[model samples]
Target: MKLLNVSAGKIQTVEIGGEKVRTAHVKMPRPEPWIITPDGAEGDERASHPDKLYAFARTGYGHWQAQLGVAPGEWNDGFFGENLTFDGLDETDIRVGDEFMLGEDVRLFVSGARTPCIKLAWRLNQPRDFLKTFAASRHTGVYLGVLDPGTVKPGDRLERVVHDPGMPSIADVCDYVAGVQAPVELMRRLLAFERLSPTLRILLGARLNAAEAAERAGRHHWTGWRDFRIGRIVEETPEIRSVSLSPLDEGPLCLPQPGQFVSVRMADPSGDMIQRVWSLSSYAAGMDSYRLSIRRQQGPGSNWIHRAQAGDTVQLKAPAGSFVLDPGSYHPVVLVAAGIGITPLMAMLEAHLARENAPAPVHLIYGARRPGDAAFLGELLALAAARDDFTLTQVYSQADAGDWPRSRITAGIVKESVRDTYIALDGRRIPVPWYESDIYLCGPGDFCDALRDELVELGGQPGHIFSERFEAAGMAPGEIEEAEVRFVRSGTAAHWSARSGETLLDLAERAGVAVSSDCRAGACLTCRTPVTGGKVTADLGDGSALLCIGRPATPIIELDC
Candidate 1:
């Protein structure tokens, strides 16, 4: 490929969305040869994009000029803000990690595709939808990293010195970023690129996670939902109830990984379908049925569950969650729980006891309001009585005189237990220290947070501590205000509030509106929706918003869905 021009730009002020911002998106051809360095070409402003050293590509200027009806002499070389405008370098022809020698002096590696954003639209004086058009064109150009920097002048020949066919092409990377589904194997290959750009690596990783998730969803035992008969209901406590269920079709049930939960879908009193997740409380090793422990909370889902009886059927999805025990680790286990949080820990403890191999020593620190408030108290005590390696400490905040431990669980109590507890190993008893154990915490948000901080302060490794809470992790706090959200295509509307702490995607699910979403944290723009009216707090460059993280910032919001 021959370099047509060498362009560099100074930072300039531009207006976007009624705000003046400094950008370096405009470039002019230099009169003489430019000195290249490890950072970038000399005299070029690159602070706005530090992840990449330079942008270089053949911008298809003639094609776009004709398509957009630009007059002659307009849309010149380097008009797309590329530093080195090339004559014949196509995005589809080059792969990441491809090395090229320019004029036999400067060496650079193709990093990844230059992702188009709103700045591209502003620089071209086009509408916001131009971002999508540019991306769909798959001619977004390539970003480069300097390898052996030297002098490079206009009309310099760019000779390809290296090419790896196994690596993803620049066009492939652009397609992946443009919401096109890539095969799992291709994504894996992209992730394995040794010299891949950091920004592309992160994006590929999130896409790989989302792709694998979709594959797992397709591999689920049942699609949509399946009916499960309620075998029995046992009142573990006045507030907690355990229901055993088996598939009505008599098909084998996929055993849940210890600490995993399943979604139960049923109709409420109003005959509206609703779904709730409940942790599996039974040992999965030899289980013929699934047992879900539910607390009688003041909600439509819980109320319907409490009012249900045996012989009734409910729709169940396959078990899911990453909170399972580390079966491969031999580290001593510390299971801490409060209230209904004990359900998952109970599964872990029981699964450990049922293991054919020698299990790791476990210590359960359970807390409740009082002795009667603790579900599975008798069952846990029986297991502890039967095993010397398994230890149980019951902490009750309002325990009576007859209760064994009559105080709330604190860091002090945990420290004392860490010093006192012992594990039997090879006919010897060794003290189980906090730092050496893998601590699993589950409970209310505040309880888990406080305990996690205290444990970290007590010299416990933060990575050794894993936690699960009642709400979604990484949820951000926002002002509580009621708002109306309308999904135009679905013809559905719902009342929303920061008080519910639900994203628009979550609201769409509850409102029975189907919205395509993957990686529901806004990393992938699969859930991006057009905002026809009203307002939302988002980070989109265009007039669209990502429903996964976008929250209503106005009293009424309308989405094209």
Candidate 2:
């Protein structure tokens, strides 16, 4: 099929349904060859939907003209706002897994059908029912995902290099979007495709039912507390130790996604139960055991953990966190961490390297106080030595004569490392642009916030960066006016300092009242407690407070502890 036109649009104010709105829906054909990247057309401006990058097939312009009785001149090559308008290949003809070479070097894969939105109706000056009509017909064009990045121009022929007949066609997806019922097996097979757009995946999953879909997405793992025996412990550094855990029942634990953490419950020196969280550092694609890399701190809970033996048992809930890697991403991965924050990023690096077909490069920029304090230094160096795709940059704040650069990790170090990074693709070294790569930042709050601001100033995409900061340290006791706190369920009344910044969970422990908590941060909702009589600093949408981090905002408060 020959490429008819190439289009790109910018954000502009336009009239939509008698109201002015800012949108990039109207695209004008460009004369020069357009650069195609993983993010889509080089100059195209997109809205909230990032998944639908490029669109194909304006061959249905004739069909639209006949159906809507519109003038022939009204439909141009890019009237549908598609990036690359082509002929001959339409929704019905393209399968989800179909791969094609656009022009010479550009490779495009069929991801899904273009799901019409209100913007489409607005652009065409038609009623909202136009979206329904567009979806009902097979005239809906197929959306293309960039596989091999290159340049595309008008008059370039679209050559189909690969096609799998077993996969569902783009038309089938459009039909499903229009609320047509399909066989369960067909829907399952559609959902199985890795390249399918996430939006369409959710839609199909809803049609198939939520439970089965959640299971497919690895969200139905076991929850709540279970007994785990410490399998082994290794001292990674002078202050950081790695503890391996296995199910006491000898059953397999569900393999955790890289970058997840498990919450542990154990007794402190005072014989009182305390909960804490640590990031998992080891991942091997199996579920036989899990490992946590804990940094020794001044807290009693941490001291107890460091003193525990291998045979000891701790109550642990299933691994949970949103700061995990994107398995489907085809972009370069850059991991930045400091001190104990290296724990989760370590898991992410190892997991990415273990992939059978890791297409992109992975770079890690880590910092520590000194060589003695860096966790897994030997392992990181060994990986860098063993793999050509891996790059490591270590900066020590308290570096000696042996350490290179001998300075603290700064935004310049990160930006320069990524700026010079390259990925080996098809025997060619392609520079990994900071704007396109997926960057993960984990460290103290101030560290993350400062680096993020600097990176944004230096032309980094804020959305492409993901960060998880260390939990805020507990407040220290100080002199302040005492406030009355009442535990409604336990019938216990205690005095708490309003200015002390202590959480309700801490007050409960001091008052000899029992409360369940995990993470000791606002993350896990295990410490959810209802605020019965007064205001709290933290509130979940259900009017309950996260007792682990929630404090009394008022002079006096009551909690259902």
Model 1 clash number: 0
Per-residue lDDT of model 2, residues 333-437, tens digit only: 899998899999998998789865455688898899888899999999999999988989888888842425677667778876766554343335544355557
Model 1 stretches with alpha carbons more than 4 Å out: 1-220, 400-405, 420-432, 472-503, 506-551, 554-561
Which lDDT tens digits does candidate 1 get at residues 238-266? 99988999988888766667887777888
Give every collision pair in model 1: none
Candidate 2 is scored at a TM of 0.62
TM-score of each: 0.50, 0.62
Computed on alpha carbons, the lDDT of every model, listed in order, comes to: 0.74, 0.76
Q: Output the TM-score of candidate 1.
A: 0.50
Q: How many times do residue backbones clash in model 2?
A: 0
Task: Give the winner by TM-score.
Answer: 2
